[model samples]
Target: MAIHFFEEDIRSEIQQKRNLKNWIKKVAAGKSFRIGNINYIFCTDEYLLEINKAYLNHDTLTDIITFDQSERFGEIDADIYISAERIRENADILGKTYQEELRRVLIHGILHLCGHRDKSPAEKKSMREEEDKALNLFDSADVPRGTLKK
Candidate 1:
């Protein structure tokens, strides 16, 4: 299971590919069964908006959009598009940093691939709980991973 991160930022920030890859592997170790290929595209909201419209038929702003391309041959091919712009906006709205919101969104997508759905009110609540659990595990420190509330 390889987690590949592609940054489309003209001015690349402090995203460490190795650390992010390790985190992904740790989170997906026994879940999702990511085997062959997994791609994460980090970009601006404009880019993700275009992707949302083109791929999902939704023309609204979102933080992350995941496309499962896994075939019957067990090749887990998938694309997860993350919107940094929306993350920043959401972080401000939730009184957290961009990193916090980004991490939450990142785990949200991973849980999605792990058969976690958040389409309904109850599902959304459960998904939030799972996201918090994942974040706590991912952090494993006393500093508290994020400031966002479920």
Candidate 2:
């Protein structure tokens, strides 16, 4: 069970990896799922856009794209790509700090692996509620500040 963070065409890093990993585990456990190898590939909007176009065939910018590769039930094995550029812009627009938006995106991918969908209005509402619960957990936990260099 591991969570790895990497950057592609970006200069950002998750400094509090240990805390973040533990928090992720807790979140998965809450959903009755176990953590497997999860790779978080952070990149620029352009980089993620290329991926979106090549793989998803969508020529639109998105905050995150999750690829689920679980081989068994209750085990998460996936690669999640995030756009740091979008996170920053979203933070400004939503009046949230950069760290807050980043954490939301991070857990949003995990929630997706846990079978949360946001395609419909009801699903989107439920997804947001789940995200809020996870964020509350993060707020009450002993996690440190997230660092992402622009």
Candidate 3:
């Protein structure tokens, strides 16, 4: 279980990588999943736009784009690209702090890797519930150290 962070077209600071890794590991374990290699690439809106256009064939700017490469049920391997500018803007628009929204987006991708989707109304509700649970896991500061679940 390795979490890698990279910055492109924007060099910024991401806080508490160690703590976040721990939180994500706890979330995955709780979901009966195992953590694999996760690369978090942070970049500007333009950079993410190019990524969206090139890889997804969509000409729009989004906060995050997750490329899941997991081959099995338990393992998770993904490259999650995030647009910092969009996150900040979204934070402002949503009346939340930058850190709050950023964490939500981060764990949102992790949830997707855990097989949570938000395409439909019911799926979106379930995904949001899972996101809230995962967020609460971090907020409570009582994470377990159990091995990854099968």
Candidate 4:
């Protein structure tokens, strides 16, 4: 019933941790699910690359990787690993601020824990739509947008 952020090979912090938790709660409520313990691990690209390779058997580096450990429909337990370096690069490429891109990735990981997949073009589109919805939730919340960045 909590969201925790940990750093690995990196010392960055999430500026809006509390607001992000509330936003996640709203998102889970919309899906008729409950918020469980969610561990967000922020790390360097090299650190996450090792996780991707060792656990997923993938040799490529990715911005985020989620390991879902939910035991039931209404519960969620996931280990989400995010690469800070990749997020920064992606933010530049997408014309979004680093916080915005990072938020998208964080929401993307939660969406995956909620059983959303992005293996196909159609699925990818749906995932994007969900991410937008989550971001909209953030916008609608009372928190200031600038508070999302450090």
Candidate 5:
């Protein structure tokens, strides 16, 4: 499984770590973890706003918007468009580092592609549980408090 970033590079991500790959695999195993390509495109609010309007027909600002392009299971293919600007704001509200929040948003999109939906109350609860599970596994190391950054 490959995790790649397209334009608007996502630097400072933990995905590049060797241990991170193993951690992700362990968390995703027995799930629909595919051995194919998945693209994560990070962009500005304006870029994502255009995509959200043109594709999803929504005007509200969002942190992560995923476009799944797979035809079958075990072929996890998707484009996750993340708005750094939105995530930064969410980091403040959530009282977590931007990195932690970024990790949450990344897992959120992946969980969606894993046949997990966060629509109704029950589904939202389940989704949150899954997110917490993943975070518990991945956030063992202290997540650095993000400094004032633009």
Candidate 6:
């Protein structure tokens, strides 16, 4: 049951990692799944674009790409790649603070592992609702606001 964060070519780190980890565990448990070895790799948009092209065969920029690696049925193990640059741009476009957008992307990937999909309009709405619930869990707890270095 481990959640590790790494930087590929980004200049930022996740603040309050302990609290974030606990929150992630709780989110997974809420879906009746246990946490496994999950690695979050933060990188530049270009880096993530290369991955998107090479692996997913999509030649476009995306905020996140989740690779589910869970072996057991009820455990979540995956490598989630995030584009910090994209997140910042999206934050500005959505009129949200960087921290708020980052947290959304973070939980978005986890929610994917929890059997949530966003391919359709209804699924996207449901996914957003789940993301909001997870975010509320973080907000209503004793956790401090998380930040990323610029």
Question: Model 6 over residues 1-150: C-alpha lDDT tens digits?
Answer: 699889986854467677788888989999999999999999999999999999999999999999999999999999999999988999999999887898899999999999999999999999999999999999884555555333
Estimate, for each residue in 1-150, the C-alpha lDDT of model 4 and write its tens digit: 799888987865577777888888778777777888999999999998899899989999899999888888888888899998998999999999887998899989888878789999999999999999999988884544445544
Q: Stretches of candidate 3 above 4 Å error?
A: 143-150
C-alpha RMSD for every candidate? 5.3, 2.5, 4.9, 2.0, 4.7, 2.2
RMSD of 5: 4.7
What are the lDDT figures for the candidates, one per model?
A: 0.74, 0.89, 0.87, 0.86, 0.74, 0.90
Q: How close is candidate 2 to the true structure, as a TM-score?
A: 0.92
Of the candidates shown, which would achieve the greatest TM-score relative to the real structure? 6
- Write candidate 1's Cα lDDT for 99-134 as tens digits: 678778877888787788999999999999988887
TM-scores of all candidate predictions against the true structure? 0.81, 0.92, 0.90, 0.92, 0.81, 0.93
Clash totals for all candidate models: 0, 0, 0, 0, 0, 0
lDDT of 3: 0.87
lDDT of 2: 0.89
Cα lDDT of candidate 1 equals 0.74
Model 6 TM-score relative to the real fold:
0.93
Candidate 5 residue pairs that clash: none
Best by lDDT: 6
Q: Relative to the unseen true structure, what is the C-alpha lDDT of residue 80 in candidate 1, on a scale of 0 to 100?
A: 86
Model 1, position 19: C-alpha lDDT score: 51
User: Model 1: which residue pairs collide?
Assistant: none
Clashing pairs in 2: none
User: Model 3 — which ten-residue stretch has the worst lDDT?
Assistant: 141-150
Question: Model 3 misses residue 1 by how many Å?
Answer: 2.9
lDDT of 5: 0.74
lDDT of 6: 0.90
